[model samples]
Target: DELQAQKAAIQRETDLADESPEAQAIQEAKSEVDSNNKTSTTHIDSEKEPSAEEIAIAQTAVKAEARNHDLANPSASGEDTKSKSETETEKLAAAAKAKKDRINNNNEVASNTKNLMQEEAIKASNNSDVPNLVTNLNQSQASD
Candidate 1:
């Protein structure tokens, strides 16, 4: 009786081990691995060398993407279109023109100021009521 009871208990323990959480997790992992292997094998079997037409189509797609990128960012593309020396030359020309304009403007301002001062001096001379120091000095010197 004791041996039979021990045998029954061992059988129950073995059954419980098969139903354990660890055993279920291991079973699930093996199923996933098998599924993945089958999928990869089928994918490999189905794959073939691309046709020339397919290759051309892929190349066209790549070219179109590149063109779109260039269109989207024009400044970032074709950076070598203008040579460095050409850009420098243009900048120098602009700076020279600006300097020339500033000098011309200053000359114009000075000429205008000189003309205004001459007009004021003439007005003062014509008005006898306003005392003119130079004319008075000249008269006094002539009398002496």
Candidate 2:
């Protein structure tokens, strides 16, 4: 690094004295190189900064590309944060759905239990009394 910097410093000093033969040859070579570069590369745009309209058009093009992707895949409704392979979010959603289904199933089981146990009928028969139930069961057993 030091050697390259020293060389650059020496070259700068030589170039500052424009009367030197080395400096003249270097300037000529530099101009030739620049001209050759300009002719060889025609794909480069001369504009350094894009205008506001151009920037807007470029942004629109990008949005259209993303919109095209969404149109093709209707499931991708919102912003895509990851690929199909990176499915952590999808896994979480699936687990939540399964949990919801399980909860619904449990609710159905509870509803079925109300019919299976005949709790309402038993409660209606008892009428909040305890001694009556015991006596009834004892008499039913005695008769049997």
Candidate 3:
């Protein structure tokens, strides 16, 4: 019974480990590598050498498969592929732009808040029956 319980515990742990994101990523990478190796290795019988036409056909098939793979995962191949330095530079630029945008947004919000508070204060001060001196003076001057 103890051995069975230990086995069950180990199996549960293994199941949990397999379900982890890191394990999943590793599995996916391994599968991709395996598939790539399988696609690249052309099987041949040692007794019979392949003809020129057969070799050409195999090469063509390999090329087609590679092209299809590139098409299916554009980031894995072609112009989208970037050097580490280039990728880091792009990331830094994006981060800087985001920070600048956030600062600008905050400044705008602060300015808006300040303007709103000033407007509210003015409205509150004008709540009395007395007319605002500056506004009345301006209106009187305009009438004159």
- List the lowest-lDDT window of 10 residues for candidate 1: 119-128
lDDT of model 1 at position 126: 56
Query: How close is every model to the real structure, measured as TM-score?
Result: 0.28, 0.21, 0.31
- Pick the TM-score winner: 3
Relative to the true structure, candidate 1 reaches a TM of 0.28
Task: Report clash pairs, candidate 1.
Answer: none
27 in model 2: Cα distance from truth in Å?
A: 16
lDDT tens per residue, model 1, 96-132: 9998787667988768766777743343355558455
**What are the candidates' C-alpha RMSDs?**
23.0, 21.6, 18.5
Task: State the TM-score for model 3.
Answer: 0.31
Candidate 2 Cα outliers beyond 4 Å, as residue runs: 1-86, 108-144
Q: How far is candidate 3 from the true structure (C-alpha RMSD, Å)?
A: 18.5
TM-score order, best first, reads 3, 1, 2
